[model samples]
Target: MSQSQKKIHYAWVVLIGLIVMVGAAKGGIMTTGGLFLTSITEDLGIGMGSLTLYFSIASIVTMISLPIAGKLIAKYNIRMLLVVAVILEAGSFAMFGFMNSVWGWYLFAIPMAMGSVIVTQLAGPVLINNWFKKHRGLAMGIMVAAGGLLGAFLQPAAGNLIASEGWRNTYFILGLGVMAVVIPVVLLTIRMTPQQKGLQPYGMDEVKHNETIQVEKTANSGVTVAIAKKSSAFYFLIIFFLFDTSIAAFNQHVAPYAVGLGYDIKFAGNAMGSWSVGVVIGALFFGFLSDKIGVKNTAISAMFTGLVPVGILIIEPENPVMFVIATGLYGFVVASLGTLGPLLTTALFGNKEFSRIYGLAIMGLAVAGIVAIPTYGYMFEITGSYTNVLYAIFIMLIMNVGAILLAFKGKKKLEKAGLWN
Candidate 1:
């Protein structure tokens, strides 16, 4: 078949590239950080908090890099950027095998965060929008499933690698191995725009060739960024992001927590896999629930689900099976940041200035990571247990409930002011 008449469009090919690159970046490298923590801290005689401070450093770098990444993605070649991004991210992970001190993690976190903000955070959605006009949600769902599925497999494999080869070689293998796989995929199949392939987006067949969604017409009816920034609702949403993300950031500690409770690293790995499974199921469930009920209820429901896991951990994590199941439940809650964050944004302010408003509010995510991850670590270090940490998560879940409530009230104030068109 001719290029235009081919059975599958190049957009799908680009999506294949995205699945490989994102899954490797997220599933293979980033999400596995916790697996190495116990070994590193125990081997080096570093405090868990002191060693995991790298997470805070990475979050800081990510926060600083976010706006710059969005601009760069808009202006640069997506393929070249992704290839380079994987190197910075995975390269840092590989080099961790060479480090002898806490300073090594603190130092390498810079490049890792810079690469991560692009590869894992921004690329999938942006590329999907540029390629799939119809079935956009399905495209995103597919990409998310790739991450969860890959992580499910990789988590246990990573645990086994760490058990056999040690954390050092596991780091090197996972890091360099992923770079080896993802680099070529990005170079070969990814593109910034469908225009590069001389074709329209996949769904354009149903509409006039020249017609595009009237984004401007819809955008004009929502809360403006300037107005949103001034509203109480925006600040409430920021608080919600901070609280919710702090809860999510605990994923990085799951392996350590399991190990601390006398489970082996292999069990921790299996637990992390269950978490990945939860992420997959939770994303689907929240999306469907939101469509059925509303963003507000779905978000509130997310906070409540978090309570179940925390309750289990605090009461009794003695059963390995139950612990894994609880971790999976928390993983379901972890997905809310992705599945509900955007919906909450639109539900509050409409679409008038979504990108800008969300960009600003999501600073809370980075800020939360900077504080929460290390806090969990230090709490473990100081107390010799994660009981206190789990209790704090319980409180935060309650706080998130209040934040969600206040955010809707703030939305009401905007509508009452006649600012909502």
Candidate 2:
């Protein structure tokens, strides 16, 4: 290795920025969302179903935006994109402070989803893929773990803020606060690729310098977007995405569920915070596990672990101690959405068409949001309980195991057909 190449890689710097940026955007905004659900509905005289429908609306926008976001990220300067993205996202979030009508969330959902598509969903995985060729799973886990760590602190804080300051003021403060923090971080640290820094991706130096091997690597691994789109592996991955998102969507109702059980907002906040802590530990564990055991096995294990929490919720929803423990365990399993999702994609399709295939694949996530978020809310509204939703989530969590197996089975077929070659 050259002496210069041995110097500290800038990819770590990019990752630091990503940890903060995505953390604040997701942990600061998205994870804190449940804290506001009941407060918004009660204050505005809206039903839970009607109010949570805005989340579905936002998901619809996210669904439409993912492909466009993929292209924009490819075409535009990332720093500039992130600056505008955070502004739109946090700005729209703050704008909610002024709305007495549901239309405010509905209208802002467009810009909010657009901005989040760039910030939370796309940037971390895409950039990590560009920068870290080794320990990529670890990198993805750290990014998601940042959100968990930050959200752990933010959730209870937000809950207390809602109690003292009201949801409106809380919204304004969080939005502006995240914007002030995330925008500058983006400009200082993020880059689209390692090439922009005149460096090879981390660990690229380890590859053997043989022409035939390089050619074979490309030939065997370079699954184009067009070919990926036609492959059964791709479709099965999408199905897994859908079921996974559906399972995770139950989190949006955690606070509301607690409230319905007569727990105060502060308790709900603390419970969600516990969930965040679970996320931190879970993300790191799964990432490391994927590296050690493999993505397929780790995913199946996660699905099984996830069932424990769902069962606890079903059997002991009103038990405060059990509720917190269950939700925290559930949060750990949900880390799969961020960690395993991208890892599984790279495992099945390689990185040749990663952005496009992943872009299309995560649309399942948005679609689940559209379908599952308000559906859970309506389940509560209609039944006067969350019992039915819990059952549905349990079923979906088990179904995810099947989906994971099917996805890998399809990938094996693709490899056998020489599509991967």
Candidate 3:
């Protein structure tokens, strides 16, 4: 019996594996890293500016690595690469438990960022693109939402652990623990492509049956990498990546933001938990909405929708309930970075050399994080409030609306030039 003809497609198996590995990497390590800010700074007597500066270091490394990582993921053996990535990410994270100086963070930040660049940033999107012929948006959403699901559980638990077990111990336990679980799952489930299982992508049959869609030709169609790189769509994608990532980078500061507002760690933990819940729901929403309403409209609506949370944060952040609500809403906006980033990439550039194009374009994330994360930290440290930061985020959201429209305009130019097929 052919795999695609079975009751379940193998792509679902690939997706399930991604959900576990990416979820663990994102939820257990990446998102949860922010939960340690307050405790680590206070306990170690490190300045907020100094510790968060490590994020800048990490971002720089990620930026430099992304293009190379793109080529490597396309060319390398999937299982080998993923295993090493998890170890680099999780191992570096666990080693944080032993650091006594800020330089330790700076040092480990290198490998950690390298690992996460593959594990957290690139893997799910690349794999889903490879494995799904249709419903790509939904698969991306579900994988991202699963990260949220793990985050919804892990964030609070890590918070409580920090309270009970100390930051060092919590770091070791979470890092090693998630690594332990994720490595085996990656080995068992992830494949570079569906062709490995002697099966076509999920929904390939349906795509072929639909006359207008033109399955094989459509799959082969798209601008070459050189053409895409020179196009206006590429530039707007960089802007979109920058602003969207800048919005999401606020996650690293959310806990500290709450504490600075006079909320305790417990409240901050729950707030992170709320953000995770929003991520799960919002991821699915963006995925479904992108497919139904189109990525451009959905991206525009997301920017406007983001303003509500920023407004609430600016106006009434002191209210405990409202603050958590704002964080949750913020999470919804952040989910777009995961669910919509790749979708937008495909929409603008088509899927040709998607790895390289998407990799190069989303370096804006690295650029944004390097500037934004430490900027947010230093802003709070200097002003003793996130007021300006929230206002800044508001502006970024507005700018992105313009960026999205212009990006599509750029796409039209490519089509007019006879590059895009």
Candidate 4:
């Protein structure tokens, strides 16, 4: 074989490794966190509100760390950054096993959030954008699907572990497992870009340096952050994210919610697993659909589809089959949000300063996390039911639909003004 044929495009390999590490870490943390909530509260003799506050602290930390983490990733070596991130994330998680009080959670949540922001949120998008030119959206969708798959498997397993071995041992085992697997993967596979391996992105015959230049020029043509902030589109996008994220807060609570409804913990875990299955299917389908149709249509469809599950939950809380269907359908909306959220930003604003603008816009997700999780928890504490939150989610779903419409209006305004091409 010739040198070109023989040359290994290791970036794609790196993408796969990153996907696994991200999947394991996120699946362990986000999907499994609620499994421990009840155990932690009962063991420590704490109120649900108090334990939920730790989740709030984690959100605030996630918001604070994101921009700093973005800047660090840009400035530092990717390998070193990931190493630090894994240590913080997995190590903080492991430390949860030893905690005797709530204060431990509040303190350790800082590092856990910091690490999570790096691995789960930043690394996938940045690395995929750097490595693949031709099928970036598909790459992102696959990466997210991997995480969902892992969540589908791990959530039930984690719940079973907690049921049998107890929460502390589960935390120790999971935390160590994430660090052990991810650290080595990051060291061995991940790199900054394809250029580091002296190759173009997968499937490219030649590097179109000029095409890249033109695309950059178009992306940077006129949309400034200042100008973007002035548009109704920006605010609409924020509202859309906030509502969408608030609805997504349901995932964290699914296991506990199931228990609240008098189901077995294992059954709850399986339901959450079903949720991830829906996420996997939705991410792949909606991602491809967005490419075929338009981001606007895809997003509007997703927001409306999200409402179906809300109705199911409201009307049929006691039926396990209905609960599973509702959570799974909810997962479909979430899958779209994961894929379409960034795509919509790029579609609406172009990619000139995409990182900065995307970073700022996604802070709305953190804001939603900060408000939504605790609010949901407290509502349950006060009302002994999620009915109020469900009603609120329905209202927010309507608002998200409005937000998408407004974003299109803003896009038209930009195009008419010759500010967007």
Error of 2 at 218 (Å): 4.7
| Candidate 2 clashing pairs, residues 3+ apart or interchain | none
lDDT of 4 by residue, 1-421 (tens): 3576676566669778877878888787766788888888889997777787877898899899878888888899999999999999989998999998999988998899889888888777777766766566777777777778888898889889999999899999999999888888889889987888786666454446667666545534547676778788888888888888888887877777888999988888888888888888888888788778878998889988988999998999799999999988888779877788877777778766666667777777889989998888889889988888899999998898989999879978987887764
Candidate 1 lDDT tens digits, 304-411: 889999999888898998999999888878777776776688789875665567667777888998999999999998899899989999999999999999999999
TM-scores, one per candidate:
0.89, 0.97, 0.98, 0.93
Model 4: ten consecutive residues of lowest lDDT: 213-222
Off by over 4 Å in 2: 2-6, 208-220
* Cand. 2 Cα-lDDT: 0.90
Which model is ahead, 3 or 4, in terms of lDDT? 3
Ranking by TM-score: 3, 2, 4, 1
Q: List ranges where model 4 is wrong by over 4 Å.
A: 1-11, 202-222
Highest-scoring model, TM-score: 3
Q: Candidate 3's residue-wise lDDT over 135-176, tens digit each?
A: 999999998998899999999999999999999999999999
How many residue pairs clash in all the candidates, one count each?
Answer: 0, 0, 0, 0
Model 3 CA lDDT for position 14? 91
- What's the lDDT for all of these models? 0.85, 0.90, 0.91, 0.82
lDDT of 1 at 215: 40
Residue 292 local lDDT, model 4: 81
Model 1: CA > 4 A from native:
1-15, 129-138, 193-216, 219-221, 350-353, 415-421
Cα lDDT, model 3, residue 229? 85
Against the true structure, what is every candidate's RMSD? 3.2, 1.7, 1.4, 2.5
